[model samples]
Every structure is written in structure tokens, then in C-alpha cells.
Target: MGGRVLGYGTYHVLTHLTSTELYSHCELVRNKLVPLK
Candidate 1:
């Protein structure tokens, strides 16, 4: 019902936020590393 839809929406938002945070962390680490050919 409506509650189930809300729960799913919240879950999706959390999942997206987690992935975005992970991606930013990875980018940060990469920026700190020395580049090689």
C-alpha cells in the first residue's frame, strides 16, 4: 500500500546516497595518489 511505497522510496534514497558518498571517497583517494604512465 502507501506505506510500502514510502518504505521503498526511502530505501532507494538511502542506497543512492551511500553510492554517491562512496564515489566521492574514491575520487578523493585517487586525487591524493601519484599518477603513473
Candidate 2:
């Protein structure tokens, strides 16, 4: 996916950070994860 897609996914994940998976996602973003899809 393109950066725009990754960005949107990140935003969606962050908005739902209450979920366990989303919490992990937040960590991934916080740690500067790349190649997210």
C-alpha cells in the first residue's frame, strides 16, 4: 500500500486505540513502525 493508505490505517488504528490490537498498533506507530498494511 501507499503512504496514504498506511497513514489512513494508522489514523484509524489510533482512533480505536482502546482495543488490544489497536493498543499494539499505537505502540507500533509510537516506535516509528514502517511498511504497515
Candidate 3:
């Protein structure tokens, strides 16, 4: 996948950050992530 797709996926996940369904996975995934923008 390209950055475009990656960006979209990130946006989708961020938008759903409060979702109970993905909370655990999101936390694990975002634990070490830092935004440059």
C-alpha cells in the first residue's frame, strides 16, 4: 500500500479512537506512535 492508503487508514483509525470495538488494538498500535504533522 502507498502513503495515500496509509494516511486514509490512519485517519479512519484516529476518527474511531474512542470506539470500544477497537480500543485495545488502537492503544497497542498508538502506544509508540508520534505525529509529525
Per-residue lDDT tens digits for candidate 1, residues 1-37, read 9999999999999999999999999998888784742
Lowest lDDT sum, 10 consecutive residues, model 2, at 28-37
Clashing residue pairs for model 2: none
In model 2, the runs with Cα more than 4 Å from the true position are 18-37
Query: Which candidate's lDDT is highest?
Result: 1
- What C-alpha lDDT do the candidate models reach, one value each? 0.93, 0.80, 0.78
Give Cα distance to truth, residue 32, candidate 3, Å: 33
Ranking of candidates on TM-score, top first: 1, 3, 2
Sort the predicted structures by lDDT, highest score first: 1, 2, 3
Query: Candidate 1, which segments miss by more than 4 Å at Cα?
Result: 35-37
Which ranges in model 3 have alpha carbons more than 4 Å from their true place? 18-37
Worst 10 residues of 1 by lDDT: 28-37
Give the better candidate number (1 or 2) by lDDT: 1
Instruction: Give the per-residue lDDT of model 2 (tens digit) for 1-37.
Output: 5999999999988777668777788888977855543
Model 3, 1-37: lDDT tens digits are 6999999999898778757657887777787574532
For each of the candidates, the C-alpha root-mean-square deviation to the true structure, in angstroms, is 1.9, 14.4, 13.3
